[model samples]
Target chain A: MWLTSKIKQLLMVMKPGVVTLNYPHERPPVPANLRGQPVFDHQKCIGCGGCSDHCPARCILVRDVCQELRVMLYDGSRCTYCGRCADICPEQAITMSNSFEIACDQKEDITTRMELFMMTCQRCGRCYEMEKTNAIDRINLKGFRYDNLEQRALIRKTSETFDPTLLQQSDQYQRPSTKE
Target chain B: MSKRKELEAKLIARLRDDVVCVEKTDPRTIFIDVKRAGIREASKIITNAGARYLCSVGYDNIERDGTLGMIHTFALDDSDQFVCCRTSAPENDAIIESITPDLPSAGWSEREVTDLLGLRFAGHPKPKKLVLADDWPDGIYPLRKDVPHNLVPKGAEDVAYELDEAPPGTKIVPVGPFHPSLHEPEHFAVYVDGETIKGCDYRGFMTHRGIEKLCTTQISYNEVPFIAERICGICGSVHATAFSQAVESAAGLVIPRRAEFIRTMMLEFERIHSNLLWLGVAGHLIGFDTVFMQAWRVREQIMWLCERLTGNRKTYGMILVGGVRRDITPEIADDIRRVMKTIEDDLAIIHRAIEKDTSIHKRTKGVGTITKQQALDWSLVGPVARARGVDIDARRDHPYAAYDEMKFEVPVLDSCDVWATLVIRVIETFEAIKIVRQCLEKMPGGEFFVEMKDSIPAQRHAITVVEAPRGESVHYVITGEDNRPERWRVRAPTFPNLQAVPLMLLDEQFGDFPIIMGSIDPCFSCTDRVAVVDLQTGQASSISKAELDALSRQQQARHASLKG
Candidate 1:
């Protein structure tokens, strides 16, 4: 009986392969709705600094060119891969990416920064257009009657003057970039 | 509400007015701040009041104002109420008096504090670098607040610390920061003679990450959860959970019920896997190959369950500030339940075999005994303390998430030996099963995450502690006006339990050193960056238990060589 029992135990060990996962060769199923690093939607970003303010790691950087506050920048190097920035975005402008293979030799490879263009005003010098692509398209797109290449040129030229100090004094002077 | 309250009340009366800062933080644990001058007298008063020395000293640099805060904490008997004695020292030249004479466990914690914070503990019997490598510079204390947030030091700078071998009569054996036996990177300089271990110096490379400074200067609040979860590979869930809780608390946001249930489930799943991992490690340490194989096999079930549920093996990234990322469908829940049932059956076999196994008994029984007195003095936490019959489970004592509603028992073993710790862990695995089941059954229906529309409230500070697999994991957050936390402190369980290793290993046999030290399921040194120092005299001369055993074996081999 002892010999038979020993034989049975040994047989049991060999009868079936242990349920080992042959990973890399056979990929396991990744569940849907996996939260990874944040992916930026440059067009929808408002440069509101919400994601940067709400970001735990302070990885988000926002640079405003249109004064209408269109573009936001993010450095992925400092990002903790926390999905809070995506969850907190009011415009639903950010989503978490599954591409977490962020190992890089250079620090610059890890940083992620983005810029969004601002909406120019139709009648006034002020920029107020947001979420109205038609109005922005009619004003800035080349084919439209109200199209103004000058406004786009001015927006491009004076973007460097969108510094916090310059943004505060925009209405104080009639001109933005030019001394005249 | 029991003897603990009575003793605490009696002790509080005798303590000097300015000497103690008493406040009740958690239900079971008391947070008492003792002045620097009263460390000796206060410890005596505490001992007379039936309190034991839990651990010795470390510093929390409150701000970059360039003052390093030195803190020594003590614990009362049969209670989680710990007293912290603190004093301010110079950031540039951090020095403080050592309390190792009062409590032996302070010996290691002080060495760690000395290594990381550059605090010179005067009168410490064996003050040496316990965490940072030998080549680390003298003045670059990683934990100091004033450390320029961006400063990464020149590589391979030698530390100013000098290593002296334990007094000549003692035999010294050195273990590893990279030993195959230990699950994490920790080194021990053990001194032994004959069959007895005289003393030990617990060392590691912990302070390398510059994590705290990085959190303040580089990473924002939303990004901190993922960085914090990387603090420990095994207990990543709780690290993320606790960090999120701190941030949410600072923002004055209460996560929804469904989110809480999901968090609870993730935490319990983490607990199951962590405990099973330790089971396999402990089995391997005792040379029980069958047990190791079987335990790891069972652990694979938990890991698979985690992967199926969370989509990652070690770093499960499901946690958010207000809620978790993924939700378990009913089908997924049923599948998990089925897998857990299979694991539960296997654990029963492991428990029985561990209890009855002769080799395990010989290896673990009556070895590395930490008496209740010693445990209390050392202020140990998690299963290490529970094995010694101290009932302080942060989940139960301080209810967080779905833990308050879950029904489970806290395993306590008064034996305070390696065997008792294993038993406690095995029993707790069953309890963790109970917790997971309760969470699954009672999981409420609601939104998975709440969208935070409003800006974060300014200057609000909040702290949270979660029961990580090893022990209480704490996250303290001080939010900036920009809605991110200005300062975040994540204290893992091993931060306290690692202090108790010297006490556990003292007077034990050199042969039994590994298993005894392994008794405390230590995680890695905190998210600190690494600096290596090479001592001219002590490079490989520092002794290890295995080295001593090798010496004895060498003698035998020489005798055979001579005869042959």
Candidate 2:
């Protein structure tokens, strides 16, 4: 019984000889739909902040510098590459590029920053376009957000309109102290 | 009368006025609110009615009612229903009667709630610190509504978890927080008398990332499926599907039929890959490299196919709250069929090779024997339970997604050992292939994704179970004011199966430890540092990674010399 089993095992081993790829040297073709690093189109962006609202990892940050300008920063260091931002983008501005080979020495290599010129709505003073049919898709944080871009922190505070005091306060945002 | 009404009548008859109310949330779920004093009696009544104990869920209701809520969930498998016994205690006096005395499997759930929510289980047998770090400060329960999600408390040095006392005339052998045999960072202190094992104690959840708390507080309901998919590396789609179904059931959302078929296919794909991965790991545990190599070689096709079907290779990110993100195009369906055929042929060759091997039989045949009664007591799931003859499969019993229409056989073996688990997994792999083919053939054409018409109402509770490749994964959700859930509890299969390791290790050879533990297919991550202490002298000191590596090399050399 042992001998017969050994012979069968030998056949199994010989059948799949050397199936591993030679990785970097002999590259396999990546599929077209592979969710890799996300790229943002600054020209097509409407500063809606839908992607930032829907992001699971909270890697995308939206800060309204003023009524006219909005700063969107994609911190690649914490990004899960789940392609959720690309899926939730109202405009076809965010695309998941097939760039899986994105290991880098500097964080800035993969990070994307988009500064868009916003055309604010006269009624709300914010540029977000809510889904007319589904109320659940509405953005939670309205008006203007003052997220700290330098520290990569989401302040979770918003004003009715763009507030200078809030922007200045968030610029010096520190992590909640343990000493309290 | 229906099973729900019948069970409610039984509970009411036994508990009398202690049964506060019975609410049938859905066709398959019955939520019974009982007084805190009669929780143990209520659980006993339910168990006597042939309902299997699932897991316990605890949440903070102090803001609204000044009480802490606890729900003990159970599955009436024969009737395709779930019975959730809900009870609460005021914040000033938050104590509940322990159900672990009646059902041993409730031990971890009660201990976890105690550690996280500060709800004391009065008569829990061994309620040591289960989920929290030793240095975590007292009187600061992290699961409460007042606690912030990102609070990091100060860490205390020289803290160690106390292991259970070894049996008389037996020495304790520690295997991992970083042992070579264990792929993950779990610590098992095995007690042995010479070469025969006496008992064992496990201290895991070392890599618990507080995912449940984070999802409840930070992310929305729609974003949680992605986070839930990341709970386990192997069963990504299983957790995602389970969480989505929980939310869908809570909001009374009916998904399209094609979406259900696609979800079924994705689950079967995961099962196929996971079973083959376990087969490979099992072979490697028994020192058979050929089986490991050939099995994984066959399993690689499915990973690539998933990469094409979904976007990524693992963590498919395909499942959402309403439905799946990607549709099964006809071309992709054909591609799946081609891959399935190739995998079936290759796996058959490997199975025939390993089935009658004497070396494997010697290693695994009677190594981890546990009776079916012990399995029932521990409430084991998946292949582990099926191997020991506790015939239960959540897919067939509960019939989630498209499984109600699919035809397949759940194989049960009575050998009650590691060998039976191996055989069961192989047969299940073939069964998974059959399910996938049937999904492709019977898939209806319709919309894959559904848009939620309105925001989910608050305080609606739902429970869902998806049979993951490893075992059954139970997800419980309660909708909150915000887009996120009020409380989401995830019970992975390893949570219960690992508790029974001490029982399975009794009277077995110490060398068979790796295969026995590997049979459960434990999924966890690694830890960086290790501390060594001399129990005799009461002295403790830390060891550097370099010294630990050199010591392990020396041990390996000594072991090889003895074998030679």
Candidate 3:
């Protein structure tokens, strides 16, 4: 009984229900929600260094040089691919791409670079967040609108004003790139 | 009337003078600050009160208070209540009485405390290098604030781990710092009297990548869960979920109900894949590659399903501190059920074949038998305990995530052997499928994320347990300033189960070592996180067979000289 059943089981397994994927030549079916190469939307990136703070592996680097420009460098090698940067981005700048096959021989191949102009907080007079993204959503998230009305009004009032020469700060931050 | 209060009262009553302060952190957890002098007695009281010893966390709080802290966590599995006995020792003379003499399960933990935090355990049976590389210099404690996490001592001295000498009349058959059987770098000296295994001595922790030090020292609170996911490739979600829950609990952040349900679904999904993978590995261990191939074939479906559901095939980085990153839509729910059904069908055939097959039964049945008493004494969890009829599942006992809402069976078999463990895993896989189906059916709709607006103050400690595929995974988190954990200790299921392997391997045939180890579903990646020195030569690298033999001789001489 055991031998016959075992033979039957072996034959059943041989029915070709289970199959191996033909890869390299034939692409493996990647799901729509697959977290792959981190896509940086340069337009939406406010250079607040939020992604760096949210990154668990410290794969993201946001260095604000002399309060003029914010240099954001993402080393994909160091990234755990947790997609926290995409999830926690206040302006929804970072999102995951489906291109997960990020294998490369050279170090430069995996590195992602995005530079944005630094914007200073008018109230604190300290450089805070990346420039060019709407700051009202953040004000709401910090609960400043409900918690303190005066600070919210000040933030809103400051939003109307900007450094006239801020547009001429750097050509690097003005690059129209949203590479996924 | 409450079990938590009763346990606390029992602890305080037994050690009235010893209990300095009993702080009820939550309804289910109590932190009893007991005198360092009476720590052993306090621990014994908690254990005797039907609380299983979870793990001990040793933290170096020298910067703030000139003292080291040790927290012994115990779980009264029935009431899902956790009792943590906190004690402190002066940094200058950081010494605490070891509980290992009574609770043998805490042996490795105490040794680890001695290794990483440099806290001396007075009565630890084998107080040796449990975490660090053997060649690591004396007085270079990695976890201490003074010694930075990345500080590699210039020219680390070569001090090989001193392995236990082979018993008289038994020849030592050393198997791996690198062996076919062991997936990771680990040294095991199996003493055999002509194939009848006499005794076993293991010198492992070679894969200790210093994750605890890395995370606590560098990583922030939000990012820790991702690093926790990398702890074990197979059971990454277990660690991630446990660490996230621990952080959330510490901060008093109650996540959304839907988020909890999603977490439950993901964990069960992980269980399905991990169990199938283990079954395949077990098959491979016993020289049945056909079963291995078939099992893996069944498992790949779940892997694909997981990828489809949560982005990645393995490290489903879907979970965050407050909630899951992704949501389970109706379409995804149907997809999960379809995949689980297919896997269920595949596993059924394999299980029946193994059950009816005489060769499998002859090889596995009555081999590596662990009695219920032995299982309890060693504090084994997961299928290992269940196979021995211990009937302890952290899901049913502790009820973390949405497990309380989900209905599933915790299969307990009294056969108490490798065969029983094999059967338990098979049945548990089906149960996991059932759980995932129920989660998909009963999942509530709401926001998947909760933003933590309040600044989590420092020094709030929390303990969280996730019933991982292997067993129960425990994570202890103490919230610190600067948006990071002051101390995060993870006690993986393999950490305790691997300790009990020698007990399982005592007199069994040496040939059955692979299957026995495989049966435990040992995930060294989670248990160890740094480079460990070899037992013989005091180096981290694998040496030649001849060199290893010579080192074994040196170890033997060292033991002989000490004995003499």
lDDT of 3 at B294: 89
Summarize candidate 2's per-residue lDDT along B174-277 as a digit string, tens digits: 99877888987678999999999999988876777778888888778888988888787889899899999999999999999999999999999999999999
Tens digits of per-residue lDDT, candidate 1, B486-517, equal 65666677766776777788788777877887
lDDT at residue B317 of model 3 (Cα atoms): 88
lDDT of 1: 0.64
For model 2, the stretches where C-alpha displacement exceeds 4 angstroms are A122-135, A177-180, B525-564
Q: Could you estimate the TM-score for every candidate?
A: 0.73, 0.94, 0.87
DockQ of 3: 0.19
Model 1 DockQ, alpha carbons vs. true complex: 0.10
Error of 3 at B384 (Å): 0.8
By DockQ rank, best first, the candidates go 2, 3, 1
- Docking band of candidate 2: acceptable
i-RMS values of the candidates, in order?
Answer: 15.8, 6.3, 14.7
Q: After superposition, how far is residue B326 of candidate 2 from its true place, in Å?
A: 0.8
- After superposing candidate 3 on the true structure, give the runs of residues whose Cα lies further than 4 Å from its correct spot: A64-67, A115-180, B1-14, B530-564
* B1-564 per-residue lDDT for model 3 (tens digits): 676567668767777787788888788788889889889988888888889999999998888889999999999988788999999999889899999989899999999999988899997788878787766777778888676665646434345778887889999999997899988878888999998788888888878888888777665676777888888988888888998898888888898999999999889888988898988898899988888888888888888888898888988887778788888888888888789889888788887777778877877998888789989989998998899999889898888889989888889999999999999999999999898888888888989878776667899999989999999999999988766788899999998898898888888998899998889998887888553434546686977756876787698788647433
- Give model 3's TM-score for chain A to 2 decimal places: 0.65
